[model samples]
Every structure is written in C-alpha cells, then in structure tokens.
Target: MDYQLDKSCVYVQDPGPYSEGILDCENIKVEQNTYFAEVSGDEKYLAVYDAYFRLLRDTNPNLSLVKTNESIHDTISIYSAGFDYTGTSKVTTKRAIQYGKEEQANVTLYCSRQEGRIKIYVNIPLEMRFADLGYRYNGSRISTAYVGGSVKAGLYKCSDGTFQTTDGRLSTSLNAAQVIRDGKTYTASAAYEREGTNDILRVKGFYRNEMFLFCTPADFLAQGDIFRMYELESQSEYLMHNGGDRGSQEDSLTAFRYSEPGVFGACHDGSYIVPVRGPLNRFEALTVRVMYYVPGKEAVYYIYAKYVAAPHEIEALCAIDISDTTTAEEKANTITLQTGQTARLEAPPSDSWQAFSKWEVRSGSDLVKLSSNSGTAVTVTALKAGTAQIQAETSYPYTYEDPLTHAERRNWTTDYKTYTLRITSAESGGSSAAPKKGTTLKKGSISYKVTKAKSAVEFAKAPGTAASVSVPDTVKINGITYKVTSIAANALKGNRKVTKVTIGKNVTSIGKNAFNGCKELSKVTLGTGVKKIAASAFQMCPKLKNITVKSTKLTSVGKNAFKGIHTAAKIKVPAKKLKAYKKLLKGKGQGKKVKIVK
Candidate 1:
C-alpha cells in the first residue's frame, strides 16, 4: 500500500519481544469491549491486550500512560481497530511534549496497522497542537509555521536563522560604508579591529552634527557575554593596537588611554556610545570600537566605527545703514556705526534642524551693548569708539528617546559667525575718511541732495512720469556712500503718475507737501526711522488706500497729512504703539472712516 503522511503523523515499528512482565488487576469498564489502564515504568515499553489482561513489551523506562478521571474523554474516540488483540503500544523517550502552558493529565493512544507497521496518533486536539507550536493547519495537515504582520520589501532575517524576505536588488550584508545627513556626506575609512576580536560588525554616520555609531553582533550572543566601549588617546593608538600595519619599531609599552574629561556619553537608545577626551575640535574625525567577549570560551569580538565631522555654516546680515537694495557682498563681513547709535543685526532664518542660540561679544565688549538678543535679531548700541567682534551663535537641534525610562531628550551642537564692528564718536568733526556730501545727485529715476553734514542725503525730486518711487537708505556718488536722511518739501508733490512710495530706513522726516496731491498714489510704506511728517505731506491723494508704518519712533503728524485719501484706507501700525499712533494720527490725515490696525 502506498501511504502519504505529514509532519503531524508518527510511525513506529514493532519491538518484537516483551522484556517486562504484565500484571493486570482492577478491570474498570468504560464500554462493552473497552477498558482503561494506568501504566507506569522507567523503560521503553509496548502495551498489548488479551481477553481479560493487558501486557507490556519493554522493561523499566521513564514512560507513563495514565487514564484521566475527567468526562472530557466522552467527546473523543481514542480507539481504532485495524489490528488483532496482540497489538503493540510504543512510547517515546524522555522529553518535553507538553504544548503551550497547559498540562495534560491523560494520554489517549490510537494504533493502526499498515504494511505490517503500527502508526500511533497522540489524540491531542489539532487546534491546541498547532496553536501551541507556531504552526498553521491548511485543512490537510500542518505544513508550515505561521508568521504574522508584515515587513518592508528588503532582506530580513528571523531569530531562527531563516530568511523572512530576500530582495536581490539590495545587499544582504549589514555593513554600511556610506551615510548622508543634512545634505552632507560621510564616508568610512579602512581600519582594523582588535586582535582576536571578530564577532561583531560596525557602522558609523552622523546624527545631527555628532558622530553616530551602531554595533550589531555577528553571531548569536548569549546572555552572559560581555559588551563594552572604550576611548583611546589617539588615532595612531587605535590603529596600532587593532592589528593594523606595523612599523619596524616595537609596539609602545604604555597604554594609550587619556584620563581627561570629555564630551562623550552613551546615547540613551542603548546601541553605541561615543567616547572622546575633551571637546572635539571643529571638523575633527574620530574612530569608535565596540568589543564583545565570551567569558568561558575566551573569544573576543570587535567592531570598528568611524565618522567624520562636518561644520555647520552660519550666515549674518547687518542692517546698519544697509537697505533692501544693498548687495550681499556689501553686507558680508563688517558693521559700521556711530557712537550712541543703534544698529540691528540678524541671522538668516533658521531651517528645520537649526536654531539661533544667542548673540555674544567675543572681543571689545565695552564698544557695544546688546539691547535685544532674545530672537534671531538683536539691536546693538555702539557705546565706545573701538572695533568689536560680535558672534552670532547657532546650533543643530536633536531629539532622541531614552532607553531606560523611554523618555525623549533634546540636545544641540554649537556653531557661530563673527562680525567686526567699528564705532566712531558722534561729536567728532567730519574727517577726510568720511564720504563727501553737499552735492545734488541722481540715481535711477530719483534725485538726492547730500546734507551739509557730509554724512547723509535727502530725497530731492523724481520725474512726474515715474509711476513708482523708492527712497533708498543710502546713495553712492563718486565711490562715496551717503545715508538718505529726509525727504525735501514737495519731493514728489502733485505728481499724478506716482502711485506708490516706499520710504527707506534712514529717512527721519517727511517735509511739508512731500507727497501732497499725488492723485494716483494708492500705497505707501513708511520706514522705521521716521520721526515727523510736515503738514500736507500726503494730503489729497484720493486713491491712497493701503498704508503701512513700521516706525516705532514716529512722534508727530502734520495737519491734513493723509486727508482726502481713499475712504476705505487701512493704516497698519506696530502693535505696541497701536493706541498712541491712533490718537496721534486721528483727524490729522487719517479720517474717521479709515481703519487703523496693529
């Protein structure tokens, strides 16, 4: 007969003879032709039955077949009859056979004959047997171990030395030779591991601006295996001890371990920790090695992890006498200011991983004082006549989870940019080094006149045909730059073609009728330095509807400065000065129907 069996079926052969004697006493009847027997011994055995007694086939062995007293057996059929009365019962050797956490008090044995061989079924519930072991039944038989959940399309291994998924396009090796972080690339260098230590593999990269290393065990790691990390004095020592190329001379007798405080610690996630002596220099590269040792076997494993540090770039913007029209090269390095004058310095807007830490005076601290330094921008007042070095410090923000407590932690890496500031006494007379002024000049479509002080200029005139006018903070004439300080009376008065006017930061005042009767003017942006506006400065501009004032120093507005403008005009001012500017400009130029907003 041809027979097919699955993993769940067990076949046994007859032992041919009985070694132990069989003694049967109480006949507990469960049915007409069936009986229950409790057998105990310490040897391989076989059970057979006669008319009124059962027999054993083997001598003393650690095998027990006990009949349970529970009624659960009523639902199960444990006997099958394809054999004669002298049938054999075979039990396996000493081993663990329980399924899951449940203990069984009874064993039901079923025997059948096929081709002169006996097949025994344990008669355990199929569901319990498959569920306890990691097997799934596919109707016919238990074919494979059941696995739940899903994995990404990549090469992955299970704990039982089996592959869960294999993708030929990806590398099966766990070695990472290159890593990219924050648009910067880091490459690993060739290095040797410690002598006789070769059970673990290492990969290194960057997390934020710090070196990140990961070490994984190459083989199965037992519970008592030792894992540790150490810091060496220098790269040469790390290379020399770790079986690298050796020179002609003998190895150094002294250990190369530094005994100084360092900016190193274990990252809370329990993978790899970095160890270094003192603070790491800018752009410095470091090597890390993880060691694993088996106590009784005297086997050692080492993993070499290395990473190169890249510095963060910091950009600075100087707003002193510089405007929107200034080129980046002109505002690159140094800042110039007068004594008792304040200038605003700003760092470029921060990205997702970057943040402004603080403003610091690295040198010549007495020359300048930081009045506001909380945010990305700071206001510095030139206090003395000297050059000062101001540094704008920034950092990379990082967050990680703690291994023990599972809490999140935050950290930062430091970076900075320095600028030179030159301050001169305001009372000093004009010097030859100062830009020459006192001459009328034209730049683009706007005209400017140098002030008598030789240090500043004022807006003079513009063509009536020009539809837009922008008063710049500084004008360059004959290679000398002069700050535009004010707008002369009627600078653009009655110019119907001018529809918009932008006042620069250096402009302190607007002269009488400076922009009066410009019928087409609809929008005006006043700079932060304006202090006063003369009468009729912006009056009779019927189309003026949008006005934005950034001047916190504004103190006065002349009569009819904004009269007869658009009835739906909206004047936006700084929030801190909302109430004051509203009362100051009310009924002067801004009508009752106009909306004032902060």
Candidate 2:
C-alpha cells in the first residue's frame, strides 16, 4: 500500500490484501473512556485529558462473557491567575523541561471540539499544577493580522493573592501584559511570545478558573490523531450512583452550566471541586527576591444604584425617573438626597454596588469618589449656584485588602447614581413645583410665588398630543427666554406609552421615574443648566437612545443613569474629554468598548 499526507488533507494510494486477524479482532475490549487534559477559567470549565492514558484492556470470557473494570480521575492541582487581561481571548499552556538554562516542550496544548465542554491537549500528566507552567518565547511578529489590532491586555493582581505579569511587549520576544506579587498590582511594557513552525496555537495544560479545572490527559493524542471529549464538565458527573441501578435518561445531551461559583455539585468520576467564575485563582510566592520595578496608580471612582426596585427583582428603568412624580411625597423625596449617606436606590440593585469599592457622597457641589473611605460628610455648602445635584459611581474586580491583599482588576461595568436638585424657582400655589430659592424646602415653606406668566400651562395635556390648550406657544418661566421646563416626572410610570419629549432650556433637572417605563421615548437633550441626574433616571428606556447632557460644568451623574438606553454601546462621549470621562466612568455597571466621539 502507498499513502501521502500534508498540512490540509491526506490521500492514499493502491493497497494490497489484509491479514485474516483483522476481522477477528472485534472481540477485543478496552477500558473506560481515557483521561484527557482539563482547563477551567472565567468559569470552572472542565479540561478532560481524553487522549493520553495507561490502560490494560484484555477481556477474557470466563464461561459467561461479562464487561467489568473501569476507572478515571482528574489531576490534583490548581493554577492561580490573578493578572486580569481585558483583551485576552485565549490562555495557552505547555510543559517544559530545563536543558542548559532553557526550558523546552515537545507538546503544545491545543483547542479541540467536544460537544459541550472545552478540551485541551498536554504531554500526558508528568507534573500537573500551576507551578509546572512557565513562560515560552518565540520572537514577536505582528499578530494583529490574526488578533484584531493588537488586543492590548493589562496585568491585574488577583483579589487576594500575588500574580505578576510584566505589562507591554517585553522580553525582546513579546510584550508583557500584566503581573502581580505580594498582593499588589504591577505592570510592565514587556513580555514574550511563543512561536511554532506552523503557527498552531493551543489552550493551557493545567488551569482552574471560577468555573473548572483542566489537565492534559494521557490519550490526548492516540496514534497522533486528536480525540475530543465533549460535555466534560456537566452536572451528571456529580450525579449520585444509585447503587448500580438507573442511569441518565438523556445520555448524549449536555447541560449548560450556571455561570456562578460556590454551588457544589458532583462529578461523574465521583469528585467535587469549588468553582471560581470570574478571576483566576492566580498564585505566586517568592522570598528574598531581588526586584526592580515601579508601582502604578489606579483611577479612583464611586459606584451606586441607579433605579428603584419593583416588587420583585426586575429591571424598571426608562428615561429620567423624574416624570413619575404621581405622589408628591415620592417626587419630593426622590430627588432630595441626604449627604454622607449611601442611597440604596433600586434598579441595578446590589450587583451594581458589589462590583466596586465603598462609595462616598459629596453634599453641596455634588461629586462622589471611592477613595473617600472616611465618614466625613460630603461638603456641598457652596452649591447655591443653579440647583445642585449629587451622584456617585463605582467599578469592579472588587479588590479585597486582606487574604494576601491581592486584586482582580477588569473593566466590565461603570456604576452610576445621581440625586437631582432643580432650582428654577416655581410659583407657590401655582399648581407647579420647583426648588426652594434662598432656602431649602422645610414643609409649608412656600416656593416661588405666582409673579408673572409669559404663556399658558393649559396647552398640551400629554406628550405626542398636539397642544389643544395653548400657553405662550413658548412658555418662558421666571422671565427666562426658553421653552417650558416640561414637568415630565413619573410621566409614564407603568405605561409603556408616551413618545417624544420637547425639553425646555430653562429646565434644570428631570425628576426620577419621569419616563421610567416609557419604552417609546427615544430622543432627549436637557437644557444647559441641568445639574445632577437621579438614579433610574433612565432605566428601561429601550428605544430612548439619543441623550444630550449639555451641562458644561456638570459635576456628577447618577447610577444606571443611561443603562439599558438602547444604544449605550454607541454612546457619544466628547473625544477631547474621554480621559476625564473614563476617569468618571470608573464606577461599576459600565460596559467596555463603548464607542465615543469628539
């Protein structure tokens, strides 16, 4: 027989006769499915070594033929990866042997297809653990041709341990992305890149994430052909053995894992491991180590809740929640914020706050920060300018100081919260409400008195409706040359109706819940003086995308202020001000890659 093989495909030539034993070999048997390499990160996913295994399979028919004898297990060892790289799309691992100050590996872990779980290949479990894994270098060649514009990945210190990565492209071979040590975060502009003859990439050999743990299996490569194991990490693996009784009903189908940790379950091979879903349990320890590096500083921010809670846990956010002022009490109490207190505004709820460090509130001249750990009350006394608004924002990879004092930094969310104070002076007993001038509201303390009216408030009854009752076709309040500060609070509370809002320049702030559930209203442009924004200020405004905050000196923005607002991904932040915007966006609940413009 003759044959030919190449990179893409293979071909065979003419062949002769075969041996007689070829057909008779059907009676031979093999042990249970072989062990394979396992990999788990982001979530504790499974890395089953389905290729390499040492097995003795020679079945004998003892009078009555019977199938028996089988066993398999995962290697004991977990890698700790605290360096959180944002642009990281894959993690690769290979085994190495030191020879003349150089470590070499004959095998590379690669990605394989399994029905449900991720599969990786390794050189049969010689030593399995995070420690066995080290750096491999092959000079850098522009990888952007394959990876989309040099996906920059920064190193993050684990939340509680030390995992260091040199930032940038270092090592003269590749740029370093990140590193962690002694529970502190560090980064360098250098690292190494591993190269291969054919550009074949592989996944890591030994690893564990918040979700799974994977190690290379013995049968990773059988006869040099790759064999994949799908559905490696499934709940069925943890199913209880019914004393040799019933088996699973659905054998082929796999279960989708819940992206979470701490939930205990069993394994088919009868084993249990805690899941780490977010950051790698990254680990590295060194004593009496000489080092030369600089410590970096992180931008500080505050995170907060932006919406109100429905009876149950459900997202109730639309436009600024101000229009929903059905009850003067909630309307009045809504925008009214107390300094030095963390307002438990609803909507995004605990998850929003959970992502960042503790947040602080600044009273008068509204602006909050995460660095202010002291209980010192926010100083907002000077805000007698144009109504003052207070809001806080926070961000994630929530860092823990103790337990080795490490951190897992990743920009997933920019939490925001705001307390609005609209001060344009409303005429008291005039069927309208505005901030109390010269003095704050103290119950019975009259607001603006009905002095003069340029137009009429009897024109439009609701939005989308042509004004049947005409006020001054252009209602100017307090002699201010501008449109009426359309009282749109709690406007369309539970109603998914209401579309289009004509904002008046003189209007300073939009009350909470104003257009909370208005799934229709899309365009919004607040007048220039609009200061502080309230939480849930725009929660479920699905179609409401266009938002213009003209406040030049605008200090703070509320949490979830613009969440779920249709095109948040297409957000237009002033380009010249993105740095300051990014600084302000450090709070949790913010998304990455959001488009910004000048």
Candidate 3:
C-alpha cells in the first residue's frame, strides 16, 4: 500500500520485518524490546512513518534515504528480531555498547535544530560482533533472553509474532518478545533486568539534562539537568529504569529547557536512567551514560593537584581563528583556560604545575582562566573579545606512580576509558555559548598515537584518572614506537599495569586487542609488517612475560593463543616459524619455551 503525502507528512512503504542486528540485551530481563521498525494497520494512520529491520548487504550503495531534516520524535518495536550470522548488534547509541551482527535494522527517527545543540544522529548500519552476553539467569543473577548467562533466558520475541515464556519455549531459538512491558508501568528507576531481555535498554524518543540533588533517589541528577524517556538502561551505579523522564535527547526542536542550582529538566523530549554507584553488584547489568554529576557544575581539576610540574615545560601550538560570525554559520570552538588563585591540595604538588601553548577565542565569555599554579590554558578562554582560534596543546608533564596494584581496589580503573571534551564558550556572537566541558565530556578534536602496540586514549580533563596521551606523532616511551606505523586495535587494551611491550621500526599490524587487558603485560614485540593475531588477541595478558614474534608476515595465532602466560617471559619466534613456533609452544604449555629470535 505504498502511499505518500507531503503537507501533513504521510509516507509508508513496507515498514516491517527490519531489525537483523543488536543483542547485548545487557543481561536481559525480557520486559520490552526495541531496536525499532514496523507499522501496519494499528489504526492511527495519519501516515509519514518509516523504519525497517535488517541492513548490510553492502548497505547504502545508493540505498539513498539517509535523510536528516528530522522530525519523527518516537516509535518502538523490536520485541525481538534476529538472523544471526554469528550475532551482535545492541549498543543502540548514546555511544558505548558496540559489537554487531544479527542483521536488518532501519531505526529511522528524527528531530532537528542544529547550532543550539539538539543535533541527534542515529543511522544504524552494523558490523563487528564480539559477543559475550553470558552471565547467568534462570539459576539467577538475572539476564536471560541470552548473553551466555544461564545460557540466555525468557527467549524474547513479541509484537504478536510470538515468544515469551516462564513455562519456556523461547529463550534463545534466537529469542523473541519484541516489545511488551508494563510490569505495571515502570518510570524513573525500577531496577529491572536481574539478567537479560527486560527492556533492551528501552526508551523511544526522549531528551534530558535535569539537575537536582538532596542526593539519593539514587542521588538526584545533575549537569545541565535533562531526563526524558522512552528507554534508558543501567542496572546500578545508583539505579535506573525507563519509559518516562520527559526531557528527551536535546538540541531543542520542539522545546528547550534547563534550570539551575538544584537543576531541573526539559532539553527536548524525555528518557533518562543514570546511576552506577559502587560497581552496583559487580557491574550488575552494565549500561551507563550519565557522564558528569551536576551537583554545582562539576569543576574538579586535581590530577596530582600540583605534582605535575616536574620537568614540566609547556609549549605546543596549533591555531585557526575567525569571527564577524557567519559563513554557513556554526564555526566557533576553541578551549584552553587558566587564571586565578584557588588551592586545594592532597594531590597537586609538583608545586602545582605549569605549562602552555594554544588558545583562539571569540565564541564569547572570552574563555577565561589564566592562573592558579599555571592556569594551563583551559577551555580556550570563554571567547567573546573576538579573535581566538588557537591550537597549542603540545604541553607536557606526564608522571606516573600508580602501578595499579589493584588500583585502590576500584575507585576507577578498568585500565582506563574516560573521555570528556565539553569545552564551551563558542566564539560568541549569535550562539552565546560557554558553560560546558562537563556535560559528561566528549565532543571533538581528539587525536592519539602510541606505537610498539598503542596508547592514545582521551578524556582526563579533571582527573580521577584517565590519561595516556602522546602518539599523535609517536614517541611512546618504553614499549617503543619511535617512528610508528600501526597498533590501533584498542591500542593498549586497558593498560592494567602495563608490563613491558615494545614494537616500533616502521610497524605494520597489531590492532584488535593490540594488547587487550595488560594485567602487567609481560613484554611483547612483533615488528616487520606484522600480520594477524586477533581473537582474545592476547586474552587478559596475565603477566605476559615475553613474546617477540617479529612477523615477516606471520599467519594465524588467535584463540586463547597465549592464556595466562609467563614461562619466564621469552618466546620470540620467527626462525621461519620454527616448526610453527615449536607446535605453538607445545600447545601453550611452552614447548621448550620456544625461542628463535633472529
């Protein structure tokens, strides 16, 4: 019944059976599900809705229709959908869960109003499935529908297609229960998903930035204060539920809002679920995105408070400036601030630290901050006095002494993965910007490099750990990378107390768990246009010890390949594969401790 209408906007062309991807089901609880897509005869037909499920046959080779003038607002279906070529596809977006392959997905929803901030972009096209749902269910710990846990529960799949049982029949014939949950109608945080498929991280069309905190209703909610909901997932950190928060994702098209002091909401639509306190029960179900707590405006800066000036000499530059504002409109962003006399020690003693290089402003508020143990160029001085657009972040002073012996147990350190870039004050004029850098940080300008394997992760603006920068041009101290060439694969795979890894000399290949969980990695090196080493790639590198395979183009070495190694750390093979590295070091028992070296 392909129909089309422009004025009131009504266009439909076969919108069902689309979602052939996504399933982190974050442990699954099996309540409601929605990767999205579908609409037929439900009666309310004014028209103008489109969403399909299943994509990737080379996606968009002129499939066209990636339009984004946006204006749909919300829709949910995915009670279940699957085709599995191996599986993987959840991470619906807010940026985190990523692993693809289940197939078909068209999720088309839109809303517009650029420049002021509501610029949402969700175009699902998948690939890359690491799959690791397993956690346990039925037996309990909850996470069914399937994640490997209790071998996947309830067996989702609905929307009337069929599948959802306590008696059982659909738990993982790929799972069903496509979308159907009210359990009585959960709002803010009912704390569902003892395991899998409860609300596949639901929330259809929402926005948020709410703020308020007498603390505990799971600690209020701070930041620009926004929380809208159709879906939100996070089992615990504090707690999170979904379905209604009414402040949708933001950038303001239908409405815009943000209250101060105790903070409130209304950035646009609705949907929020923030909370992740104390590993929640050992990462309970895991699905967090609440970035920065808005208690007062999150102004923490104390990376060693001042102990950062030892050998601290700053001077690194890169600039570009413009004003009178308006070319196509939307060109104003520069950060670097410092200027004051504020002190709080217990962690800033390299005599407080000092360094410089870079600042180009005019977005307004003249991006201020010039001192307090060397203002260290922050947020490009809230720009407004015109003339900014500078770039001089070649500053240096990287000291380390937290060898991560359990990393204080767990205040923070999954070997690190924090990234924030909320620099406000956008060259003033018609945008009025300024007052960000803490909406949970992360917006642009990030380039990293770390060779002899890798390390260029970002987001450590105010400390609490998360900084391993240096590699844009490559000079990775000890573990090598003097000239550099490759090592992207998760570069450094979480430096869990990095244990010796060096691989430079015009490198060639190492990506994919480039080092995966270091756990005091045990020395690694494989120069010479390397080749293939993927899969668990080095698994959790438990005291890796030694493995200098110098690939002249090696071939194959994946799968628990070197589980919990450390046969005195020395297995450098390459003498023409030395009988396939002496039968893979006697099937990893360590064949005569393999060693060919030259």
Rank candidates by TM-score, best first. Answer: 1, 2, 3
Deviation of model 1 at 121, angstroms: 99
lDDT of 1 at 163: 26
- By TM-score, the best candidate is 1
- Across 383-462, the per-residue lDDT of candidate 3 in tens digits comes to 22232232323243444455766343222111111111223233322133332211111222232332112333222122
Task: Output the TM-score of candidate 3.
Answer: 0.20
What order do candidates take by lDDT, descending? 1, 3, 2
RMSD of each: 29.9, 24.1, 25.4
Give the alpha-carbon lDDT of every model: 0.47, 0.28, 0.29
Instruction: Select the stronger candidate by TM-score from 2 and 3.
Output: 2
Q: What's the alpha carbon RMSD for model 2? A: 24.1
Off by over 4 Å in 3: 1-489, 493-512, 516-598
Q: In candidate 2, what are the lDDT values of residues 124-232, reduced to their tens digit?
A: 1222111111111111111111111111223334454332324432111112212221123233222111111111011111111101112122112111121111111
Give one digit per residue, the lDDT tens place, for model 1 in 145-236. Answer: 21111111233344642222233211211222333333344543211122111222223223322332222222333422222112122222
Least well predicted 10-residue stretch by lDDT in candidate 3? 299-308
